[model samples]
Target chain A: MPWRRPRKKVERPIEVTRSIEESLEDAAAGEEEEDSVDLAGLDDATVVEAATGEPEPERGASDLALKLRETLAREPAPARARPRATTYPESGVDLAVDAARGLRLRNPVLTASGTFGQGIEYAELIDVARLGAIVNKGTTPNMRPGNPQYRIAETPSGILNSIGLENPGAVEVARRYGVQWAALGVPVIVNVAGYSVEDYVYVVSEMAGTPGVVAYELNVSCPNVKDGMIFGSDPSLAAELTRAVKAETDLPVIVKLTPNAPDVVAVARACEEAGADGVTAINTVLGMRIDTRRRRPILGTGSGGLSGPAIRPIAVHITYQVAQAVGIPIMGAGGVTSAEDALEFLMAGASAVQVGTATFADPLVPLKVIEGLAAYVREHGLRSIREIVGTALPRMVE
Target chain B: MIIQQGAVTASARIGDLGTVLGVSAPGIAAQARAGQFVHVRPGTSFEPLLRRPYSFNRIRRQEGEIELIVRPLGPGGEWIASRRPGDLLDLLGPLGTAFVIHRSARNLLLVAGGTGIAPMRVLAEQEASRRNVTLLMGGRSVAYLWPSDRLPPSVEYVTTTEDGSFGIGGRVTEALPELLRWADQLCACGPWPMLAAIGRMREEAERAPAAPGRAALLEAQIAVEQHMGCAMGVCRACVVVTSQGNARVCREGPVFPLGDVAFAEGEPATVGLVS
Candidate 1:
């Protein structure tokens, strides 16, 4: 007789169907357990079972199949449940923060001074009411025509601007944008830039009763104009200017610090001592770009203030240092493009953040940052975003 | 003005002139007028940040397509120019003010220089069928000249090259006086020097006695270019001194009446008095 294999035993279709049903039931039960039960307490085999949703081995199964099933069942569940730990909160996390002592806002994101022109310009493109507040273009006691041609130039990841604080006089700005600002439903932080303490007082006095004016952002560091940075760079001048403005208006006074200052922290401290409610750490760093082809500087002024991601690290360091040194709130500015960047400032002790040149790249950046912060808050299961503020600071030994 | 992602359908180098890109942006094309421009994002990242503003080189509303003439100069411009078909572009437009064409005017003169031909080309095509339109374009040389075939057949095209390699030998100013007399209205877009030349001519006409087309020169509208930021009115980076005050190029203009723009030494006049 020819060599013949032993007669193979074939299982009935009904039997096969029953086995499959048993296997599926086991898998379903494993998946249910994985969904409802905490996997952290489970053993390695149970975790593998939960992960793979594989059924237990059947009787008469091949050795190979048994071994594979055993290996899968023994494998540990993936390190963590998932990257996102918690669902978005029903009420959502609060993004509100204070720009100054009494200048509380619904969000921590505000438009930087000068970058946002009186809230009316960007109001057409975005919902202005969503912003923490808007710091209007630098306004003076008198109308300014601003810098010459080529007032702006693009640097690596930032913008260099020498706009020379161009604005209609305080009267005109108040007259032109008062109703518009009120209508926009966004608080206005008047950016006051002046040649002297008297000029600052004049501007504050001019804007005293303007509707929607919530506070004042003293732009003492406008590097584009002559003598504009004097008050910002000198502690005494800054203190005097802050005191004069404080005397003029009951509005919260925020001194915008200039990085070009020989000692920025001293100026901040002086302003705070002079009754400033808050300080915006670090204005644009002075920078220059030359057009090799033209054989000359690109800006009308040889130097312009650089603002963007290029200055973000420097801004954060300053905010961190100032936050430790000052008692008043710190409004962090300079290259705050995302919620993470804002969070960096917040954790470093900033009470709020201002978005500047990044707005040039994307008008919706501030809004996006707000959304991102909310997402972060929910994911980390933080009760409130403010809980993260100053978390990165060194603790006191006392 | 809306921001939309437009897809490039075609891109090609137009000799030594610039790269021409056709983007399918229905919203921008539908609302676009002659002098309005689109701020195009260079890349997905913010490395070479800041959108590049380009006046629409060609707009086809029915087809929902817009064209841009991009000179690959900076990294941003190079990135925009190198875009191929199917690439997406972020566009914010049709922004800024548009060139205003008076309906009653029978004769319309459009002047352009170098890349400024973008808006002028649009004016030529749009006004060709409605009025007696003449487009006077000047470039540094033959390399910078806009292709004649791209213009509408109805438009009367005149060109000047500084090198005498094309049309009239010299600047558009050389060919402008005779045409200014023939035209009832004038619109121009060009470099600061070229626009300043026209502004000087307008000033001269205003000082002298009334003559044919003198009024047109006085009322001429020109689209200007500057080192722009935000393209939105917010940045205040593109302000040029105007008769009224400092006017934002992105809002008050890219288009302004020639008489309103202030020029000093062939550039936008600087505001000398800060106070």
Candidate 2:
């Protein structure tokens, strides 16, 4: 057991390098000159270069782009130089905010479904509401007691958990949290999983009308279950499931893929063609843990999915592949606990990032990652994240 | 709810106590209770990402620090074994509900597992500080029992071990009937089976009248352990069933009145114990 320490008394304004906060006060000093630099319409390489190739800030690489916002200490008249931010709030000291598919976020970081709870409990230790959005733990069709004991097994640098998607089903969830979700200041993405294709469609369709839910993530990669995960691995099955959910609701549907698949692109493409609005790249990598004393598998389910920093590179690879194959935005995940890691995924092709296992280790990982991203962009003189999306894909097969 | 691993103040192998490590935090001693625990923060080890909950064993007034006693289970527990004085560790604190003692209750019977003594030690000390207190401590053997050096001399002590290697063995509950007959209030902390047995003992004793003076007091309180997630109740990993359904052991309580909580037969869950 660990003990506490005296709270550190130091309080300093969070550091900033380059951004609008510094320029806001200068409006009274000069005429309005629009800095409307559009990186869009630029070829993919140029946009990528504009985003990733710009010189990084010298003061702090770990500082989030939002943090580096050098705003004028005093407010000045609004001129053409500063156009009103599109729907998203820019006044926050942290700059992870952006808008996509009608969803507004504080940052580009979130916890993968099943990795974080409803976002209330960690509030005392972590800034839960400050995150881009919180994806509640995966909810199933019926109340699941979950797997037997020893559900989690530690690995060399990761964890294998066969929680079996334990949760209170949809109706009860709506009964318990419908009001709270509506009240939260941030967007709430609910992750849904099921035992059968019909189960998946039902959960999705039900969530479509559920209040407080802005988007739904379909779990297709869980290795702990006997049924739901298999559909995620088979392209045809995934396509059918996606189509079924599409026919039932108009909500933005994000198909969460499994790294266990032989070709993740096949699964991603299938979901896209079937009408998924977007894709969340790479779920946990299938893994196992053993107990020598019992001469048996450590987890009751025999196998679990591996998460944390161990799966980062694989997630990036899958994200890159899927981005090229699909037209909708991609949400990248797996071991992304830092801003640089988020940047890596954005360069790889994901429009956003999720920090999963790192949340357990450090309550502040997501908030820090968001700030870090903004700091990265500002230091390099990039005006918007659109400049860097998919910056790392090769210009050609060269 | 503020959880952060602090540096280790000291680590030692106390005879029979298994291993003892001290984390440097000033707040826990002032705020921690007998049944509540701080989730152990995740260490560099991959086995456990969450903090481990340890019962507060002893608070040395002279040192102005708290101590935790535990047995090594794996790399995670062994990590606790590896700490040296001044080594920082992840600590989340003053967690769970405490053993509730009514002001009217005088006599107290305290039951403990190998090192479940951590938090109970504080209760013992607090009660001993003001009034009379008796402790009925159970262990696997005399060696598995914590030495009295960390405890106050004022605590009236009773001992029992499984092998009868020291005091009366068989089971800790065996010692409880006598204590339950005498104590106005009882507090127990130990492995689930021992706790359940103690729970059973309380049930049997409830059928009989309390020794003359103690009529209004209900049953004893037992600390239930489970897989603790964020210690903040975010994961809902630490759960216990009650008439009201499941409640988080980490957030609702490690200490709960035996009569109020629903009991299920299963293996003991050592959640935040690895922090």
Which candidate has the top score in TM-score?
A: 1
Candidate 2: tens digits of C-alpha lDDT, residues A222-304: 42245435767888888888888778766667888888887889888888888888888878898887888899887767777
Give the DockQ of candidate 2: 0.29
Across B204-241, the per-residue lDDT of candidate 2 in tens digits comes to: 65786646423322567778777555566555556656
TM-score: model 1 vs. ground truth: 0.84
CA lDDT, candidate 1, residue A50: 37
lDDT scores of the candidates, listed in order: 0.80, 0.65
Positional deviation of A369 in candidate 2, in angstroms? 1.1
Query: What ranges in model 1 sit over 4 Å off?
Result: A1-91, A222-229, B207-210, B273-275
Task: Report lDDT (Cα) of residue B134, candidate 2.
Answer: 80
- lDDT for position A198 in model 1: 81
DockQ of each: 0.25, 0.29
Model 2, docking class = acceptable
lDDT score of model 2? 0.65
